[model samples]
Target: MRVRDVRAYPHRVTAQLFSLEALGWDDSWRELASAYDGCGDPGRIVRVDRGLFGVATREGLVRASLGGAVLDALAKDAGAAPCTGDWCVVREWCDGPVTVEAVLPRRTAVTRAEAGGTSRGQVLAANIDVAAVVVALHPEPRLARVERLLAIAWASGARPMVVLTKADLVMDADLIAEDVRVVAPGVEVICCSTVSRRGIERLGAMSGEGRTIGLLGASGHGKSSLVNALAGAEVLAVERIRADGKGRHTSVRRELVLTPGGGSVIDTPGLRGVGLQQAETGLSSAFPDIVALAQQCHFADCGHEDEPRCAVLEAVGEGRLAVRRLDSWRALRREAASMGTRSAARRRRALGKRPRRLATRQRETRRGVGR
Candidate 1:
């Protein structure tokens, strides 16, 4: 954390001396990297800015540009672009320019639908083990936002953990954490305060030794503070909450920082909207209590809305489940379903256009033959 500590063991603070194994590489990555044997070194994307990438390889950190193949993949699907926490192949040319040749397969990716009404999903961070959803306790926590973030975390194929930050600012932190546990169902919930250093060690342990944890939440949630606390230094800038209790966006980009214990943490900018895109399993995972109750419904397709002998509604009636929770589930379900419909329509439209495109290509081929 001190200047001497950073200077004494420079590799510990920087992206140097991190072997492939330390970066969570495995047999799968080894096999995948085999095809690119003569291409370049395998690296992990530590940051992505504009169209450039900061890749961490065995040699250390290097700024690189996207290669032609990677750019083409991005043109087809934005999600295919390299994101923080992604393992990629980096190549340096004799002309003094480094480029990302290809991105390896991702084990897990935190994704959400694009903000501007697009059915396509955007990859936030890839290859994360734990998705920490930070919720501030100062201005009253929003359970709805917690549920939405938990759903996204579940869909990412990572273990979701609810971190109640700013606990020092609130008196009833434990009580609020219990309530959040109810909504998160099977997810782990812990309350911590960077101001008082409460529960920081336990949260920090999740990123220990070859593990990767991603911080996902809105602004003013103390995510950057947590990263600084865990790293034992001011690795990132922090901002105070506005006078109106609104959050100020401090993290402008997604960056993967290597902590002291050979672990990594990916910090992302505040997400304004996390639109659900085909996250059915995630919704079920986020609301397991409701899913379990729905299993006993008399009708297999019961909508839980004014349906006869609906177990879900019955639970709500008997005070077994909260009405607002069910309403939140319904809203997320509808949003995911709506996005699914739109995504399917778009796929069908693309399929319909494919034949015409092929025909056009065939005509061009014949014209070239004639020429």
Candidate 2:
């Protein structure tokens, strides 16, 4: 199957397919194309269910599994594991089973730290251009949560936008917008209502041709409803929130869908918790005001905790800066730093074990030679 044939699918469906740009196909894909000339099939992973994957190819959709070779690659670097929106090469067995051979590179990846206090990062979606952080107005919103998500999104090398969901439930949108502004200053915020179609057009316009946007938020935030409304079809399954106004994980996995206007949207299951790992750069970008203030502090290493002449503390005391915002920034920075240290230690330990294994391998090789 060829790329041209794959493009013949319906425009809406084809938009969800991986493109060479998204796959980082400048020179590496060319190399893979040459190497796998007649040995494998190329496709993009559209959905992942349990251990099985639904891939879109020139011939259509096919279920695929990771072959031994691919699994070995994944073991070497879990980051290389096949993820939704990844372009891969596969070999079709005589029995009609498809095995993933290789995963193409990604231009942009949206990642977050693994939940449950793990230091490892988990890739949510790959090759994304926009990371839309959705927040609902029904539950009165949580600005701290939005800030955390914005930090992760910014760190993922994707443009971050805040989508205020269930806007129809709020009588005073200005108050909600004001609350979000404190946490996500300088970021674009769009109030969208699936019931009223508010800001849907703007949401559609943000996704342009050849661009992929990722939708992220807690469950019951109306993410699936918004996607379905924007797609102009019920392509995704919708679920009702529980009595506590929480989501039921209607969208179980990450899958890309094309908007009726243009571009693509990657909808994912509601996240229970978002952890930060190696997100220092993202934090700095997300809290630029705090970073800027720190530069003017009396001491270079000021912790802003009862430190004399601390600009951040002084600003908070003077009511110029919200204390909650500062606290959130500090908490995230500490968490990210701690996770980074743990991750570094794990890498060092792994590297330390390699030499011992290599020495054992060499001893065995020498014994075999003597025999």
Candidate 3:
């Protein structure tokens, strides 16, 4: 139940990390945590909800809270806030609650633009090695949605693997995977059927001890079943897809679980929006084919709208590239570009730039300065 009884002794903290390597700790973490040596115990944040958090340390899983000072620092830098899969330092500890002093640098994080009318960025999962974009084949794969997730995954600095789930539901899974591959460019497309264990081994092979993989998808996409299948047991709850192909959220929060496959898996609730947070490099990485085509265009900065000799437009017209794919790329590019502008304005404001409201500029002298 509770580990509070053991908090009186500091030795338990080291015991909790006995399996730290199984949770993604390695020589790198030890090296980065050098400065924090003896300051506090090391832990990995497994989940966060409301203001409470579940942190896994060498002592054991401890219920923790961010100290006021640590919270203040993270408020100014959302990127440093604790998320599932963050390596952290617990300076003070008790059985009832532990105090998180600091969060270490993330090796990779799956970030999305905050939804609900916010320009801030939200980190979904941190220190992940693989961003698995899960899609189901029951109805049909949503290529546009896959592209958007791929963009976020690419921007996260982790390798993206497009996992097409529910392969048993489709007769031509390979054909559908090929269709998705055209839009995904360099990303791996795995056709996995939890029912048949089709690509489960391959997926497991990619995950080993000391590695972390994140599962990303929408509801009714069978992300739950896939996660359970990967763990080789029912580590999560699941529900059948409704007749309309929509299902209620099986996972209410992002959580990390140790997989029997020898790595940790972060199971995240289906996202309502895969908003881009100024991911220009992600756009290019996700749509390498289109970027390569543009590089061959007569004008270096061709918008591919109506420019003569536009290779992208030429491909779409020739059926070599689907119009839908090109449209998706353009839409994400425009969104990221708009977000970049807003981010720059926010930076300027933070730097004490004058507000446009009462600021005045010099008027040119045309006939007279007053005129």
Which candidate achieves the best TM-score against the true structure?
Answer: 1
Off by over 4 Å in 3: 1-18, 94-96, 240-245, 349-371
Clashes of each: 0, 0, 6
lDDT of 1 by residue, 199-224 (tens): 99998899888789999998878888
Q: How high is each candidate's TM-score?
A: 0.90, 0.84, 0.88
Off by over 4 Å in 2: 1-41, 93-95, 241-246, 351-371
- Answer with 1 or 2, whichever has the higher TM-score: 1
Superposition TM-score, candidate 1 onto the true structure: 0.90
Q: For residue 116, give model 1's deviation from the true position in Å.
A: 1.0
RMSD of each: 4.9, 5.4, 5.3
lDDT of 2 by residue, 300-333 (tens): 9998888999999999999989999998988888
Q: Model 3, range 251-347, lDDT digits (tens) per residue?
A: 8888888777678888888887878974998998999889889998999989999999999999989998889989999899889987888777878
Error of 3 at 357 (Å): 11
- Runs in model 1 deviating more than 4 A are 1-15, 241-245, 354-371
lDDT of 2 at 53: 74
**lDDT score of residue 106 within candidate 2:** 76
* Structure candidate 3, residue pairs in collision: 4-95, 12-59, 13-59, 16-58, 16-59, 17-58
